[model samples]
Target: MTSNPPLPVRPTRTAQPGFPWQHFSMRFSSTPRGARLARRLAGERLDAWGIPYGSDAHHTLTLIVAELSANAVSHGRVPGRDFRLCLSAEGTTLRVEVTDTRGEKVPTLVEPSDALDGDGGRGLLLVAALTDRWGWYPCADGPGKTVWAVLEVGTT
Candidate 1:
């Protein structure tokens, strides 16, 4: 039930806002390899934005992306359709958004005890624990759902 983040308005088509923000968005095939590639590329983008590889922020964000991506591939996947990952970093707040082509499988954080059998299912729990905030919503642009996580890079 989380709301979508507001995007800055631009007066002119060629004008760029003077804000310290970085964004990366890409669509990937809804496969395990695609998820892995998304995670790696996300790390690269964060590093290019000065978070650097192996830093706490870099690691946390990467993990969040990986978990979200895995969920997109495993649960939300629609065969022949692709998933999308959108990343936006503004100052200390880094938001990770992964959208997949399935609306019925809304992500829910289950009880830890219920999922502690170790056959997986800890992804969301780990994301919830490591991130400042996280949630999902039905996609505004298409027929799917978007899972998101936010991290405060400065605090990490």
Candidate 2:
């Protein structure tokens, strides 16, 4: 029987000093299936952190993850490269970041007139509506960028 090769491991950075935090990170293929997995895993992590499944924070964060992950797969895909999802919680803030290997395709908030009347161009809008803050930065290590969203979760 033939054996499959082990997947490549990706580096994950943790939080700096002064604040206690909980973190989870993983990389997924730049495909629709990977995006779906990102959303599911984020929901599971939030539940493990004591955020109830249906709470405002849990629901909001999950939605943000879904939208961001979908965008990464659709717009930021690089052949044979994967996208990354990172979740970090410190105090009342939950940060969600999705990184993809397409630095030049930096996302911008859609202007009212530019948005299509249909289903397209609404991802960032939902993100903006639900999260406390959202933005993106070009990755310093290589040819990619990380888009991040912050949501405020109340202590249980």
Candidate 3:
């Protein structure tokens, strides 16, 4: 009996208008230093994309990247696996996505607590506060998840 050939794999693509879209993506080590580098690189890219370094949009995006990257490193890290950072800018909205190698540790927003003595567990809180919207999803074609945040320019 002859076995059928394996089905061809299709690459995933994001829907976009005919207009040009700007995007940047990179993988970083799953470490604190890597998180720091993600924030720095994103900041530089934002500045280059006409968002001034000290503007509200720039600052907010930087904070979002910092928190999300930190969470990926702390909660989603796997040995010998690096996390991925992706940025896409279309029109006035910028989307930041960080994918890590731990799919089971999905992130959820937590209610604010009266007690302020905790040593950790506030990364998502910060992300929610800074971004216009944020969410997480398991990778469709891999063994990990991506945490994403979106910020709109000129929005408070």
Candidate 4:
């Protein structure tokens, strides 16, 4: 079984040392629309941090968020629940996390078979391919999960 550690609750105050790290977060309904919003918001947040839209780093991070967020909405959605998108850029490393109210469905990465088409069954695979490292952990409440990925950004 994959080991999914539990995540600590995010404090109500954002005062931890190096805490903010240029971050932004939003909770959206766990729907297709929410997934789209997560991707757009990620780009906007990256832009605010000076990673312009369409830039390599921005594009890569957006794509990563897109896949992970979509997976959460599609595979991890729970009725009446929402998913969250959080972005943090510290120095050159940009961290992105998507959390959903589903703890049982941990993400796994595997090579896509030739029989698989590019349009399907490629989301997590793409995430694993693009992210420096990625994994899932139980949400602080113990009833949900969060999947996170990290990407390094620098002048291209």
TM agreement with the true structure for every prediction: 0.85, 0.83, 0.83, 0.80
The digit string of per-residue lDDT tens for model 2 on 1-156 reads: 999999986333222222249999999999999999999999998777777677677788899999999999999999899999999988778899999999999898887567876658878988998888899999999999999999876533
Backbone clashes in model 1: 0
Which segments of candidate 4 are over 4 A away from where they belong?
1-20, 114-119
Over the stretch 1-156, how does candidate 4's per-residue lDDT look in tens digits?
899899886434211222236878899889999899889888887776677666667788999988888898888999999998998878677888999999888877656883275556777778777878888899987588889998766523
Error of 3 at 119 (Å): 1.5
lDDT of 3 by residue, 58-117 (tens): 788999899889998999999899999999988778899999999998897666682245
Whole-model Cα lDDT per candidate?
A: 0.87, 0.86, 0.84, 0.80
Model 2, poorest ten-residue lDDT window?
10-19
- What is the lDDT for 57 in model 3? 73
Could you tell which candidate, 1 or 4, scores higher by TM-score?
1
RMSD list, candidates in order? 11.2, 10.1, 11.9, 13.1
Q: Which stretches of candidate 2 lie over 4 Å from their true place?
A: 1-20
Q: After superposition, how far is residue 138 of candidate 3 from its true place, in Å?
A: 0.3
Count the clashes in each prediction: 0, 0, 0, 0
Measured on C-alpha atoms, candidate 4 has an lDDT of 0.80
- Cα error of candidate 4 at position 2, Å: 66
lDDT tens digits by residue: candidate 1, 42-156: 9998776777676777788899999999999999999999999999988677899999999999998878997797687788999999998999999888799999999876652
